[model samples]
Target: MSEQAPAGWYPDGSGSERYWDGAAWTAHVRAPQPAPPAPPTDEAANVFSKLGTAVKKAASDKKASKDEALRLHEERAVAAGRLVTSGIFGTSTIEIYEHGFVRVAPGGERYAEAEKITKKTPYERLRSIAFGVPEAERAHDTEGPGSPIEGAVMQAMSGIVRGGKLLTKGTAVGIAATGVAHLASNSARKSNLVIATDKTIHTLTNQKHNGFIQVSQKEHNAVAVALVEAGNAVLGIEPVAVAQPSISAPPDAAPPAQISVAAVAVTPSLSDRIRELSELHREGILSDDEFSAAKGKLLAGL
Candidate 1:
């Protein structure tokens, strides 16, 4: 259209900013910059007093719209990497992206409104995975009724007492009976697999109390492990044997490169570490005291 007007920072049809170089598009690209800060306004000057109110209102609306758009964009990006599951209660999806992972509730929607949490750096996120399994919690029948014997006894007693009334009390009676059988079968464990990320803990399960639909422990573990591996792969994390730098070199040769264990340890830089700790604090990962302690430690390292 109109010969592209000798392009100089024109829209590139993609969200990212690309250089047109006045002829052909260049390889250089950058994420769109944040909207410019609102210009300072002064109403007391009286010259622009009348328009100040209108300008302020427009600015407020624009800021809100921009914020919502940013939030949605982030949510979608995080959700794109999600791992699907056949959870019963509410389908839960966990996604591990480069910066972090997001576990959204239900099968769809992708948490468009949920905040997009970011990890400080890929190294720290991968480190968490390498360390061990994350914390987990699940819904299990801690105290439903009693043992199978009690359930059977109750079932019999209820049947005898209610007799024809069993039709109306059937559901309640059935639940008790099932609980008893469930406990007796040594199936008191939870079906859900909850795994923690740097920012969030995600739960996935097929435990609907429906006998027909059950996720075996092996399957559950597979999903969790797969998620971890997939995330690690996405972040380019893998185990590698490190060759020790030669301690001795020719007299005139450059000193053998010393492989500092601490330096070799992959972690975010000091600023990134601080930012991560801040995020953890915001997400309730670290209590006030814990955050303070961890922050102090990081600072001390510096």
Candidate 2:
């Protein structure tokens, strides 16, 4: 909104990056950069916290054996979350696992305590996910989920109504409360991830604990990829071949006379060869044009 917005690359309302020359979008555009590889913490959940019964059951069936339940609850290291600061509310965090993801409230960064509230949504519940702001807004308009932040608030409120028994129709009350939450939920405005599940939509940002507004792009990208991977798994799909960069040959490559080698030795500098060509050119034994072109070809082999 100001003429002083620093010159840098910003999201151009699409998946690509556009250059902002401190005043307006420039002609220089580039393809979307892939999320860099970051090792995720092997954080796992031992038990469900102040989460709703529906959420708990969705992640792990209560009637199943303890071992089975524990296995189901194990959080995979696919996507690790970041801690975000909330004024007077401590820190909030989100954890993504193999099966689904969890949303922890702003009371603290940790979960599985009596007071901490959480919401878990399995990959099976996810219908679609969009990364950029414009696409996410379209999904939010057409999808059926409430805001992830509002979902937490609603879940907390559900506890109060459950004990009070002030209303005969609890489900109707939840529906009404959700409608209000949907309108009031603007957490996605600062988010880098947008998820639409069968129950609700999640718009969240991955930020460090001290900085409330700044997003951790590395962590957000990691979480975004992990979410999409999990969602794809649920839908019986696989990530694109370029998702994970590998130097090894493809599965179908033959071993005989393999030309696409992983590594090839390359000379760091060709100063010696250049010197030889320079001498030949100076001695008039080789033409200046021929020596200049031939000098570079020497490195192309060794």
Candidate 3:
């Protein structure tokens, strides 16, 4: 109207471009186009890729160094202080040190190419340590059938007590059952060295039956030697020996046989695993947080 405007594309308020024919708006139009994205450079991609590779390489290198260091350290560990664990989980070792210990998982001893690993725990975290039989073994020992003839004979004799009126048929049956159970449990006794820390409990058990009915005092003393070493390392004192409590006979019944596990013999000691971890830590293969985390996880398992 005031002057003929130049024919060109212009914004149409709806945000698309429209062609002005100098007299009126034209149907020719298009939505506003976005600028093309900048091309990704090889340098940027390479930076991240190289970084990842470097991280992996570093980890690999550290692992190799750690295993080498552990192997060397293990060579110097006291034979008595080096305890082995061989059971359902496989073979492992626990190397006890003055301040702490190492738990080397199965195959961890293969330095420079080990898939198994080690964890470290400070003795300061140790809560309690004792020698005893684990419930699993006790359950195993009591799983067999007892002497049926003995049970029946015992049952008959029990019925004769107190003019045959002291017990019901059910009571006689119970006594026979108890006698049978006792017979089954007389298989053998093995000891375990149980160490409990803030995070978990570690049990090192005897690999074989140390006795027929009960582990001998000599065997107990053998395990106690290892226990004393652990006690000194953790508690900084000696543990007192406590006598097993005797079960008294009931006034109306015969005295029931008791099985005591106090000072039971253990299979072996385990202290090498933590020692290996300490070796790695001292050599800077693992950092403080890494060592602590590894130790906590290892102990959390059996």
| Candidate models: Cα lDDT each | 0.44, 0.42, 0.46
Q: What is the C-alpha RMSD of each candidate to the true structure, in Å?
A: 25.3, 39.9, 20.7
lDDT tens readout by residue for model 3, 1-31? 2237888777888889888878888898899
Q: Give the best candidate by lDDT.
A: 3
Per-residue CA lDDT of model 1 for 1-302, tens digit only, reads 24555765545677788777766877788877777877656644565766787899999999999898777666655654543322222234444555544333433222222232233222113233331221122224332455322243344345545652232244344445554344222232323344555545555543332332221232344455555555555655663335556666677886554431211222334665455456434533234555566567657655
Backbone clash pairs for candidate 1 read none
TM-score of 1: 0.32
236 in model 2: Cα distance from truth in Å?
1.7
Name the lDDT value of residue 56 in candidate 3: 99
Best-to-worst ranking by TM-score:
1, 3, 2
Query: Between prediction 1 and prediction 3, which has the larger lDDT?
Result: 3
Per-candidate clashes come to 0, 2, 18
Could you say which candidate leads in TM-score? 1
- After the best TM-score superposition of candidate 1, give how far the Cα of residue 61 lies from its true spot, in angstroms: 4.6
Better of 2 and 3 by TM-score: 3
Off by over 4 Å in 2: 1-124, 133-191, 208-217, 240-302
| Runs with alpha carbons beyond 4 Å of true place in candidate 1 | 1-90, 98-100, 106-170, 173-180, 183-187, 197-199, 203-205, 209-221, 232-302
